[model samples]
Target: MAAEKKTAIPKDIVALSFEQALAELEAIVARLEGGQVDLEESIGIYERGALLKAHCEAKLQAAQTKVDRIVVGADGGLKTESAEIG
Candidate 1:
């Protein structure tokens, strides 16, 4: 069998909650914008920032999918039915 491919993302990054990831991403953006980091460090931070952004987006999508389902009534009024979470 082919060797399993390891993920590029660090475990720490993967473990971070959505809020934490977003905060880190914002800090990375600030550092990049400040123009103080050297080229190599900047590149590394940029990569991490990209990963953080992806993590945040994924968290948002998951939350959206988990939100309560809305239904339309026969009388044209809106109703919300409890969404079944799997």
Candidate 2:
């Protein structure tokens, strides 16, 4: 028999790109809210959802430190600086 793929833990999910993590989180939420999963499955889904949420939050927190820079005045050049977007 083929081995079943294991779902990632929350920490592993945090390593994924924002888009990838968000997509997985959305899917988990849909499954939980769909009302079709059994109690056991629902519990598992809820766990996964929590992990995804944590991963997404960590990702956002890490991204908050990024910054961008711009230069102006006579030369009208560009500069590098910390980005200030959340």
Candidate 3:
């Protein structure tokens, strides 16, 4: 009998830090770019990469919101600026 592979749960992603998720995403990109992985493996990696990307984005957005809440001015007013910055 062969050992069964465990399916990844949503909580697994929640547990991963932004850095760890980004690292995994980079590895996935490198593997796909190398053109060595088969179609099925590539698809699986792509899916995982997408999830990691979303998780990273969410973390970044949350951090940005936290930073934006702090206004740096003598008057102590809410800072209003372009949310999308290059």
lDDT of 3 by residue, 1-86 (tens): 01111334367877999999999899999999999999999998878777777778778987534223345678876675544443
Kindly give the stretch of ten consecutive residues in candidate 3 with the minimal lDDT sum: 1-10
Q: lDDT value for candidate 2?
A: 0.71
Q: How far off is residue 50 in model 3, in Å?
A: 0.3
Winner by TM-score: 1
Q: Cα miss at 47, model 3 (Å)?
A: 0.6
Ranking, TM-score, top scorer first: 1, 3, 2
Number of backbone collisions per candidate: 0, 5, 0
TM-score of 3: 0.63
Q: What is the Å distance of residue 76 in model 1 from its true position?
A: 42
Write out the backbone clash pairs for model 1. none
- As a whole number from 0 to 100, the lDDT of residue 27 in candidate 3 is 94
lDDT of each: 0.81, 0.71, 0.75
Best by lDDT: 1
Candidate 2 steric clashes: 5
Higher-lDDT candidate of 2 and 3: 3
Which has the better TM-score: candidate 2, or candidate 3? 3
Candidates in order, TM-scores: namely: 0.64, 0.59, 0.63
